[model samples]
Target: MVRVIMGVKGTGKTKQMIDLINSAVHSEHGNVVCIERGGKLTYDIHSKIRLVESSNYDMGTFEFMKGFISGLYAGNYDITHVFIDSLTKIVNADVTDHTLEEFLDWLNSFSEKNNIKFTVTISADRELASEGVQKYF
Candidate 1:
């Protein structure tokens, strides 16, 4: 399953994701992974959930992010839920709209094949976002 929390800045998207991640830690049988663009979430997230800082890897583009995520799954097959704190922040500022759409489409398919659930927080208004980006939300 793929869930998206879409809204503008300061709308509590991160808080919502934190709550979901913290709550899932108690009941999920498999591992829970949280990916953030920076170290901001180090304290709010539960200690049990595996937190990854995207800056540690070459994920400036969504294409690279796909490989990074695939490698994570390859290394740890037990990961069930992957929470991306801010999808927009991980990508390079100059990327094309097509890149975002392609990555999201691939993510949805990848989750289906691996039985992993992905919850992403996108900091953009649903209406103002591109048709490609809006579809994911």
Candidate 2:
């Protein structure tokens, strides 16, 4: 399943995502991963969950970010949940409704295929989000 935590910047989205990740770590059986734009939150997240800082790599496009996620799934078959703190920032794009829909469609399919749940934080108002993406919020 794909879920979104939508809100503007400095609205405590990261804290919410961290809380979800920590909860999953204790409640879920499989592995959990958290991907962020930087390493600032590394120490804040539970040590059990894998925290990845994408700023260390060149993930400047949606395709690149998708490939990076695919790589994670390939490397670890046990990953059950993935929490992305800054989806737009990681993709380095001004995601419009069209782009958001396309990305969500692909992500939904990928989540189903891999049997992994994805919870992402998108910096936008609930009404501004695409209908497809808003359903996950």
Stretches off by above 4 angstroms in model 1 are 93-96
Query: RMSDs, each prediction?
Result: 1.8, 1.3
RMSD of 2: 1.3
CA lDDT, candidate 1, residue 49? 94
Q: What would the per-residue lDDT of candidate 1 be over residues 51-128, giving only the tens digit for each residue?
A: 999888857877788888899999999999999977878886422367677777899999999999999988777666
Residues 1-137 of candidate 2: C-alpha lDDT, one tens digit per residue: 99989888788988888788889988878999988887877888889998888878877788887899999999999999998888888887554647777887899999999899999998876667767777777
Q: Which window of 10 residues has the lowest lDDT sum in candidate 1?
A: 92-101
Worst 10 residues of 2 by lDDT: 92-101
Model 1 has an lDDT value of 0.84
Clashes of 2: 0
Question: TM-score of each candidate?
Answer: 0.91, 0.93
Q: Which candidate has the highest lDDT of all?
A: 2
